[model samples]
Target: MRGVFLLLGLVGLCNASVLTVNDEIHMRSKRSSESEMTRIRNMSPSDRPNCQPGVTPPKIQVDTTERLSDLRNRFTAAGIHGYLVPSEDAHQSEYPSNYDLRREFISGMSGSAGRAVVLQNKAALWADGRYFLQAEDELDCHWILMKLGEEGVPTVTEWIEANLMDGQSFGVNTYLIKNVEWDEMSKDLAKKGITLKGVTPDLIDQIWTSGRPDQPNSPINALPLKYSGKSWQDKINNMHVAMAEKEADIMIVTGLDETAWLFNLRASDIDYNPFFLSYAIVNRAANTTILYIKSATSKLTASPTDAATTETVQQHLNTGASGSCSGRTGMCVTVKEYSNQQLQNDISSAVSTTTGYVWVSFGCSRAVYSSITAERVIQDNTPIALQKAQKNTVEQQGMRNSHIRDAVALIKFMAKLEKEVKEGKHWTEVKAAADLKKHRMAVKDNRGLSFSTIAGSGSNGAVIHYFPTNDTDKDITTSDMLLLDSGGQYLDGTTDVTRTFHFGTPTAYEKECYTRVLMGHVDFADVVIVGGTFGREIDSIARRPLWDVGLQYRHGTGHGIGMYLSVHEGPGRISLSHSSFISDEPLNEFQFFSDEPGYYEDGQFGIRLENIVMVKKATTKYQFPGTTFLTFETVTMVPYEPHLIVKELLSQQEVNWINAYHKTVQDTIGPLLADDALAASWLSARTKHMTLENETGSGNQQTAFLSLVAFAFVTHFIL
Candidate 1:
């Protein structure tokens, strides 16, 4: 059996190596770069420490057929008809580490995106385009592979509808699923006469003993009040008030961010999401109990003493003579010390024994717990999510200040790139990317990059969500198009921006494509539809021009932006498809969305124009109307190649928008730049004025006239 498994593993490796010459060249070039070494070194010290004791890599033991048989047996014994396995945790991280490896453990597929549904007789795994090849190769042939986000492929909900029998129950681990997701699933299944079950026992851990790692218990350290701009007591008091309004006996907070925000704390327990593994229960009357691993103190203790001391003293100190702290009177306890499982059991027992109702807040973990019984957990946008989104006065000001600081660094980087590369000084994509990060770090209070920096040159830029790796040996040449999508996290706020440019004079096709993409971007920004849905808005604005030319991008036009949290936030977004699983559907007015539209030519180059827009209310006589109003804040400071912009392709409106946007960038960022950068900004700002005919042509002869007509038509109808 062992020999057979080894042979299969070797076969897979051999198959992976059967690549084209281009692939070999790309792979070899990537292996030779020093940037790759820098990336490995840059990871958290624990991931690759210098003096850590070496541990053997976990052995991969494949029991192909037996594993499936065992799962089927468990389903029968537990009275569960089926199980749903999602790829992400509470935070939808595309590339999750070992901590969130449930999907991989069950199906043996390692695609960054995918989900699985296991039934007694069969199973299926669903993935999107990027993972089709990888998923097919890694998953068992017998397990069905469903292509996701495409026509003809049923969604997980649709599949459940078809397979679930009346009165049948499906199991899911509550800790792994979010509240919004569970609510949608439960409502859909209920309509089909099927019940969604939350399995108390984590079946995945039982079957896969070797894959699960121990949960890290680092102490929760306080984020500076200057950064968070709120005291822990205030946040907790607010939660208590929200709980009272909802009439919930207790609000169960499961998401790490919610816990961190409530406690005014931060941790490196999870990458990107600065949160520790913890849970909390806040009663309507303001009483509270915290469930957390005991081991966290060691890590939390290492944080700055001033911040830690502030939190510890606040937690234990009495707020006043009333003998209560803030609005609530509560106690904090460790999960291991308090025994969460036992506490939950007691709550269940009390509910059944008494006639009173049980009210709890729902998130991914809490939602799963709600699914376990017949009790209905009222689902709503978490108080923390709402409070966090409507930034306080200080937070809003912080965001504005952060963008200005970030813009200065970006302007300098862009100016230097053009200067150095134009003089025949060659630079690799990796080096350019590193330079951007270094520049961002130079800002005072800048923590790090909000996400990975994408610096793609030429054909590589066309991979819309392209993340450059060391193996990406592409060079920034004078003839190539370049796309740099990046952002930074500061003590003040988070930022994300993308700018595509030409190193030198671009081809006619490139000019046309860039202009069309820009047109789509501006159209979306200028839209003033009242009560418009994102699905309808994106289809007509971003996709129309591309559709007219038989061109389109595979990705969404926009996604919701976070304050200083996740870059791709939710409850608000602009996309063609309706995602029922996320809360706060039908994005409210004043919400932020990225107005990005692009065209990708598989082997040549990609063009994208992105700007963040906020929904706002338009004033009118005897009425108040809402519309998607955009502000080209220019969080990203970079120059578009004037020589590559086909002025003839742009309408008068588009030309005006472009000129105005650049002017705003210059005005906002000019004073912050150093001497050399200020000079470069002056030069770049003037480039926007250059025209195809060296004259401002009449609207009748220019494309801007056509755009004006369209804009007028849209405004007339919407207003």
Candidate 2:
């Protein structure tokens, strides 16, 4: 039956000639035919043109360099020496594509990852590997194009330190930086004898003179209770219990993602981010309320039984149920009926009745926007952020399973690419990226990509954080090095991984940079810091090796990783500075952070090693005395390219860490691959014995050396 449906669906799609609900139905129907579906699925995504080629959106184009000059003048007039320009949407979302193209408007750098620092005398645009070629072509040559992660590129903080003179004040649009990033910037600048300012500047939109189009509210279809695994009442009750424990009488959910998760509804207002504009409140006594535009007919009580009932019964039931669930004594209110004034009055009245705390969930936009003071909403949401970061056993298990499946898909895609490239077939970066996306889509229960895939080759890789466009397309020659950083989302977990491989022989410089980055990656994973805040002077651990060689990536060493939500979720991060956008907010417990360290040589090549690390508290052991420890679980499964690794550059301990990590990946993912995928030559080639032993020190050997040797031998062979 499924095969028949798929056949019909494919036939309909081929004839339809245009996309519509019918087309979607046809596509979905074809989803069941594994063999037949594979044919359509094999089409290259890069070839489909999801985004237009060579046609820059007006919002993403810069008319002239005068725009930068105007920004500088505005900053000087406002008594600010520098203004931090971040690419963001009107909603101030982390997803840059959905936001207004601010960076592009000012500097003409079109990569998704970029920041412009407009100083009185100089303007600089910083970007990563994916944008190296694109940014150069689009951005004004006068603007310093600093490759991210390089020493000279300077982080936003480092820029402030070097450029801000004594008594010079730097300003950042507070909304642009998250509370955590803002706090770090503030503290770091303060230490350098510079004052950070949060002055509102309208010059950005003034010069651009355009606003994002209004996205109409669309109908949302709620998932069934069974699919959601919980009822509305049950979820509300659990939230009430949590509020009681926090000593908060009311819990306000501000983050749209959190609201969507709690309500079991999806919206298309934003691409990639499935959230509707809504607000939710739950009281400690189990009273729940939500405010949202009525975009869809309520089907809250619909069940399988209803579908089986007679037509007449269904019609009668639907008619009667429509008006029954309005704003009763304790029901959620439609946003239209409950005006802002009335809602504010209700909140004020509720607060006056109790001396209780307020619990605000993550990314509370409405709550923050409505606040008269800076700290009101931020303070209330801190605890909730911490709570959300700590994953439950079920979530962790889901993550582990997700990574295994994701790794398999990635390995398969890599094999396909190797075959194509080795056969003298010319492939574009866009095509390679599309192939990966196709493989990800093939996985059952997989949603779309968690983020855009970064497919860069050769000199393109030198851009620390690159976003590919058609104009920047590069042909994948067999002799080129490739850096593919990508991830996907499953219903159960989110995955992010980066692998740098040499299509052929690599230069000595490339090998050295890859080794350095790998060394830093290994160093960070072995760190056992306990009770340390992300910005509390702990960033040096990952940068120590790079710093020794006078090199670094301009981007943060690590960012908080989300679970089935924002690619960059927070309340926890690993960065150089302690202060973030919002001050006095506590870090989330058990939140995951990406451990990525990289080095880039402009017009040459770029290298980065990234893996998702989940924090876990370790019980204090009194074995030695006064030792506190914490452990991080490695969740990414893709293997590093051993052929490009200069093993001699790695310390014995670093080599041990790599071998142990690979063994873990093997153990976790080996059994899950299909026979054909498992038998692939690449998989077999990966199973070789990792070189663990090396020449011992001729002059001197310490106890640490013996311990490192013992660890390498034990971990290498154990798996």
Candidate 3:
């Protein structure tokens, strides 16, 4: 209820559509970014940061016993034996809006990804390893904790099958259950004589109706084609052309990124992710579309389409210099608020023209498909996800520009962190995260962080996806292996990167593991696209070094990143586990993904070095028939800590990769710091060439001081 999530929530009435491209706009987005950067530069750092360094908000007390009792009553009233609650929105997004966090509301377990299953007398919550420790502390006594992905851990489906009696009924909110999941669950439950029912008037919502936050009244606006590269018209044209090939009447874009790109619109409905919550339907036959969203009373117009009869719409596109929504085929997209009656009526009318069926994403919730009055619903395997992943010329350039600026901010954070620790001052985990956010906010066009900043120090770093809190705040020291994973959301691009740093001399084991992780990072990222390329294939390259050392992290090696969208986007990714979730598309030019290899030892240290890299044409000297290989070009600009490297352990190529990467970091960050002396000095010292002597240097305070001031004169003067 924080905001009407328009990202993947669409109630569409499309009259088939097609497109014709308009004149391309160049760098209007760049200009906008520059203007935003100028504004941030003009303001003080304290004035810009959205996240403040303070005590973590107290946890909201929810009575699980009372909630479970009430949910059971609702289940009985609906003639259901059990109900399943998942932490998801209508779209099966990893990060759901606050309004859709039903599982958290019911069970008091607050991880981003988790689910709760409740019956008359029994209830259990399933959380993966990342959330296991946190979940144990957060979940109440009544709920059984099922640690997913662990040995002997039964899947929720398997547990339901084994626990439920024959002929018993199972219920879940159809609006929340993804279509594919519903299909699988229904079939599984059906085989056991259990009826799977789609129950709504969700018990959780009913229990806390008055206390729920209201959705924001922010308007959805045009994202300016300069940033998008393609007009919404061009995007729709592309989709319609594909729609024609598939012989589908319409493609229902329920994913937030899909809808955002399709319309070239962005809004802050959810935190960090610059998107509004709305549903969109575009017709492949006629130039008509319908969007279920709110009215624009602020800066952004309500409806920017050609024309609309509805009074709810208050904004219109200027069609002049702006890369506005209405550009080609005279597409008039209707904008409206959420209304079940209106949506059903409009969708029914739209379905009347299409003969075959309505095109919905396979990932769409069953409730979305059931609302449409088509003869049948056909699932679209070819979704907008891939198109979004493969960046255009403009987007690729924008990514480079954004990350360069982002790199400066990150270096500033690390530099400040080092200065504080070296001065023998105490720095808490939350404080480090705040400093990072503060630095990112000072950069131009930064909307907010891409996600919650992870500044895990010592043992906290072992917990992947750990959110630092005042309760677990560790004092960052000179010797600890601090895993800092964070990213920024800029107008031009979204950036994700991580670095494990050490201020003092590292232990032998730490250095070995760090160097091995670094080797794996460089090795995997430097890998050429050989035969039968898949996520798991490259993932092994990152894990082999750690595997040899009899150590491994619990998480995936890498994941796809979005351009100013979700930090973790998909269609392609590199992960040993759950690779099938990503489409098996061959890695293509400009498709961005993370190259992160890590090592986490319980209660001792955690080392992870991550960089956002892109698949690009590898310069080939020797080639074989039927082979066109791609290589990753690292885009993240930040210096690696030299003291932790085991120089002898690294191959020459790995060492070269590190040095070249460090030079790029210095070259990229030095100029940004030319205007700030202290930060410039700090970055200059951190990125000095990595070598065996430096790696083996004695741990002396005097030597650390001279090394820290490696280039004092250069730091003071303009580059």
- Angstrom error of the Cα, residue 510, model 3: value is 2.0
Q: Which stretches of candidate 1 lie over 4 Å from their true place?
A: 1-83, 90-98, 104-112, 117-124, 128-145, 157-174, 178-219, 289-368, 371-376, 418-426, 470-473, 529-539, 586-591, 614-639, 675-687, 690-719
Angstrom error of the Cα, residue 325, model 1: value is 7.9
Best by lDDT: 3
Q: Write the per-residue lDDT of candidate 2 for residues 1-719, one digit (tens) a residue.
A: 32322222221110000011111210111122445334332322122121246644333234456777777768766788988776654234555343356766777765555577787766766655435556655654446665543332345566556666778898776645444345556777787688878765446765665554444453444534433445445555666676666677766555555565565555445555545555555556435454443332343233322221223211322223332334344434223222334445556655565667765543333323343222233234433345445665666767777888888899888877877788888898899889889999898657678777888788878765565668677888778788888888766667788888887788887888888788778777775554443322334456656766788664556666555655665555554322223232223346677788777677777788888888776555453355344657788887788777877666766766777887777666666665656335576466455664573421222344344334423332331
Using alpha carbons, what is the TM-score of model 2?
0.69
Clashes of each: 16, 25, 23
Best by TM-score: 3
Per-residue error for 12 in candidate 2, Å, reads 52
| Candidate with the larger lDDT of 2 and 3 | 3
TM-score of each: 0.72, 0.69, 0.82
Candidate closer to the true structure by TM-score (higher is better), 1 or 2:
1
Candidate 3 lDDT by residue in tens digits, 310-342: 222322232312223455336455555545456
